[model samples]
Target chain A: MVSLKQLDLTDLSVRQVNEYLHGELLEERPAGVEILNPDGLHSIAAGLDTEVEIDILGHAGYFIAGMNQRARVTIHGNVGWSVAENMMSGVVRVKGHASECAGASGHGGLLVIEGDASSRCGISLKGTEIVVGGSVGHFSAFMAQAGTLVVCGDAGPNLGDSLYEATIYVRGSIHSFGADAQEEEMQADDFEKVAELLSRAEMNYDAREFKRVSSARSLYHWNADAHQEY
Target chain B: MCGIVGLLARRSDYRDDLGKLVTPMLDCMATRGPDSAGLALFRSPLETTSRRFALYAANIEYDWQSLADRCQRELDTQASLTFVENHAALVSPVAVNTFKAWLKKTAPEVHLLSVGQSIEIYKDEGHPEEIARRFHFSEMAGTHAVGHTRMATESAVSPAHAHPFTAGEDFCLVHNGSLSNPYSVRRKLESLGIAFETDNDTEAGCRFLEWRMREGDTLETAIEVAQAELDGFYTFLMATADKMVLVRDAFACKPAVVAETDDYVAVSSEFRSLAHLPDIKHAHVYEPAPEQIYSWSV
Candidate 1:
């Protein structure tokens, strides 16, 4: 059986809550922890390094669960900007929609958004796999260095701009693709990768309908003749 | 960074709570922008024949009553002025253009913030809560409203730099990003005989829309043209007498979220601004597409 702990945010300030979660209190590493009444305040559960599960009961504000390591942080309601930014490992799930820069610049982790994600989702991602069950706004996966991003719904304009080694999979329409990001054929192996991602995110969708987007490789090497294309 | 919020009531029951609802939304984004705050409220027109115009005074003790009395005697129409802090709203039984011409000739010092049948604009350089408290926004009622909190990326922090810049009668706009080519755009509009009140890029964009509308373009066409011409990262929340318009640039660097329910429609720079709105949980929340104009009319 897993151990459970509860922290009520209404009675505590954000700093106090963060201090308690970051200090020796969580050193025992409870299996699951519950945070109540977040009320959309900012910086909840930020910079957490524990390998425990944290469940935020209500809406969260900006930078929630940012720079995480080996912890599963879940928000039951909507999330504000940069949810799970620069996470090194583990999972961060938002049950509702996310605002801008969701899962931005993460080095390693699986960030699952059950609902739509706003603009700049997974911006400058580095080795993080972001799976969105719904659509994503513009500039998703912008200048991503590595990892994979799967959008089950439509992607807004300028998806995967200046992409570097990162892969994008979209099941629905794409408004427009950014520079150096182009469509690629989804082979059988690509389907397997997308299937594994969907199962890991616990979302149900048809992977066969997804289109793959990756860098054109033309921008990696600088050539004087290619200046106009840039 | 800046924050913009707009609320339009789809039902009559929500009209009375417009200001009350928008105040909290503006306050939620207080941290994003700390330089200044402003709002444009659209109340229902009174039963009388007078049109409403909101004016700004250079000082708090400006003689607004004398101006009203003089305008009433000279224009030969019933006129009234209600003072609020450094601003006042004038109601007069005269044509808008005629009244504006008279004011320009007589009271050169007074600045016209807005002139319409229902719109009243209040803005100042301060915290969002302080500005709202001084204007008594929580006690006012309206059918629709737009609020802006400024971070002052492009201009000096002053009352003239506050947002919800009026373009045409009952039309105003609030923006949340900087423009790269506002001076050239301003020059182009100036050559077309459009006057500017401030050097802010948002005012240039607002006047561009007004100029396009005057050239026989619809609001949608004007926005589409703006998308092709304006070079910047912006998320704009614009309002007319009966409609609210939302637009993001092609890159969509600036954020905008919209929530719609059976009773009302609200748009904000972030979801936190809309989190406390009534019936928001059940509402359909989504982010608007880049360069696509999303508008709703009552």
Candidate 2:
């Protein structure tokens, strides 16, 4: 039998709920937790380190499920900025659209946005697999050092700017690429990676239809004639 | 970070509830901005021969009836005043120039907020909820409204520095970010014989656009020109008597979320501020892309 705990934001403040999620819940380890009346407030289920299945019922504000570890969190409505930022491990899924910087700077995790993500999505991504069912806005994957970002829809301008190690697969049109980020021929591994992420996100797109983007490695070298070099 | 909001009612029934609808939107954005708040509401137009002027005075006990009498006695202009606290809405058949001159010579301390057939402006330095309550913002009925809650980054915290800054007749703009070259914009406009009321950065942008419109550019063209001339981060929500225009800068660092439905179009700096609108869950909510023009009719 699964024991479920529902926390109403109107009845309990976000801090008290977070303290509950952070402390006693770890010992009880309830199988499921539901957060009601998000009401576009900030930091609803942020900084969780649990294995419980958490669900958010309404629209949430900034940093909805940031810094997650081992929790399967789902937001049923749209989320504000930087959902699931800096996650070491977990599955954070937003059923609706996301604002800016979704899954930003996550060292590890599978973050999925079912709707369009705004500018700078996955910015500074260290190692997070982000599968977006819809389009992504400008400067997505900026300075991403590791991980894979799969965009099933169009990518906005400056996609994968200053990228490092991380790979991007966009199924639709790319407005433009940023400095040092370039579209490379998709290898077999790229197709496999996209296929795996799409299946995990429960999206239905042909992995072969995707294009890959990665760093050019031009800015990594030090030239004597370039003057200010280390 | 300041917050900006605008609502245009396409449905006739919604017009009567515009204030009741938008008051919570403004008050909800108080988290983003707590220093001051202002609103510009557009009602059904008066006669073409008549005009409306929104007046603001520092003295809460200022005599608006005496000012109307003075307009009759001095400038031979018939004016009616509807007042609450330090703000008053003055409706008259007076020529704007004649009324402005008369005001300058008579009560120099009173600030003229806007002039048009439909627009009425109210603003003050305080929390948005208090400002709304003081002016009875929830009781106002209008076709559309533009409002601002100012955190006052680059300017003082006076009521004058608060937003929904007005320019020419029936035009006003609220800003959510700072400009980098306001002094230069001010210098150029001053050379063109345009005067400014405050050193606020948003005032510079407002006057520049108004001056361009006066020089025969359409609002769209003036905004296009402003995109090049004005440099900085901004999500500008502008309104005329008939139109509400929203635009973000090239970088678009300042946030703007727009929700449009069959009944109305709403714009705000954040979705939290817009979450209270009727049937907002069904509205087409989306972030405005960078450097794009979105205009809606009242």
Candidate 3:
């Protein structure tokens, strides 16, 4: 039940603060918990099972709110790698650019990166809904098992390299594809998902402009000498 | 440049969370190191006598199976043949001191990486996730774990050129830069029966460390020796069950950042990945000195 604003976190490391507040804020926490300086440290608010409302003011580092079972983390600046990694549940919002693997391997949650994200934004991602207002780096969603990744800007190379069940909607050009990935015309279900994610991110974009990329599931297994086309 | 990551945790810790706590952190570098990714995890009840080998054989041909068979036959008695792939992990129940002697006499072309009880390795020719999905890398759960993501420069993409090259059990490596003077040092290791799988510069680097360690040097000393012997713009990361070593070559061409707190420590190729911590007001980030090697043992 500690508000991040009142917590005297000046004396401890980022990890130390996380350790100190372990399990103290959960399930709709008070709005006072706010981070004053967010440099490239890491794993802030990780393993939080509480529904605490934590607001960060600057750029953050990797695995922010990682493995978060519950809790709401909001960042006002750009974010680094895997912002909401392996999130079992909860909501994370980034007001600026997100580095690579923004929501990678996430299980379930709503992640909003207000700006661009670098490569592999949702790799091995499952059940999570990720929305990016800007472009994504190469090989985004390489092995996405399930869930949805919606990008408002351009996408980088090898989009969905080994895509699984997940669906990706990009408003930009795709660099290429691995053996099992391909670009498909957007459908109703795809439109719905993109619309929902964009709305969750509080973005107002035209869903019709995006294209869907998914797995062809053609070369799932290695034939070695075959064309290796997906 | 390349990025390498490994993990070794108590078995009790594994069943509790299923690698959920660490995989995302490991996957965070997919862009910084987009070429390829690989990881090996080893469980405890680990052996202290096993060795990890990094052979740098000369005149290696496309006939990998034949060469591997020859290696097995030559060191058949002392080296019990286990799984044989492009790379193999062996359990050395024999005395650690005598194991190299047996290898020198049997398969003189073998360059030992390290020796220990349990070992795991994964590598490939694409981005980290590409390699990870190809190998189902995250399935590995052990007390000891290590991973690498490549950005191919001096080496081509091939299985033989992949990392965690075995020289002995429990000793494994993932390198992130290139080596100069490979031919001369490779020839030296080859003279001592260190066989290589590919012409990749990293192979030579791994072999040099193994040879030094075999000559009665500790991991630190061996790495130091290799640092002296090899020339390159490199940053090499090697992991053992109880220790992790980071070696930055002359000029330190690659980027490496290390962050640690009382609870845990994490290292990555960039500063942004570590910026999210709640209390890192002035997150102290620095790079390794050229020709200097840093090691941490748990």
Which is the leading candidate under TM-score? Answer: 2
Positional deviation of residue A22's Cα in model 1 after best superposition, in angstroms: 0.6
Cα lDDT for residue A209, candidate 3: 86
Measured against the true structure, the TM-scores of the candidates, in listed sequence, are 0.93, 0.96, 0.48
Q: Top model by DockQ, which number?
A: 2
Preferred candidate (DockQ higher): 2 or 3: 2
Native-referenced Cα lDDT, model 3: 0.67
Q: What proportion of the real contacts between chains A and B does each prediction keep?
A: 0.32, 0.53, 0.53
Candidate 1 clashing pairs? none
lDDT for each residue of candidate 3 in B81-194, tens digit (9 for 90 to 100): 433223344554456656567657755654444455655565555666655654455554555456666667776765556666655546677777777789999898889888
| lDDT (Cα, tens digit) per residue for candidate 2, span B73-94 | 7877677879998999888998
The fnat score for candidate 3 comes to: 0.53
Candidate 1 chain A weakest ten by summed lDDT: A24-33
Model 3 chain A poorest 10 in a row by lDDT: A1-10
Question: How would you encode candidate 1's per-residue C-alpha lDDT over B106-148 as one tens digit per residue?
Answer: 9988888998888999998899999999888887789899999
Best by lDDT: 2
What overall lDDT, based on C-alpha atoms, would model 1 receive against the true structure? 0.89
Superposed model 2: Cα runs more than 4 Å off: A222-230
Q: Report lDDT (CA) for all predictions.
A: 0.89, 0.92, 0.67
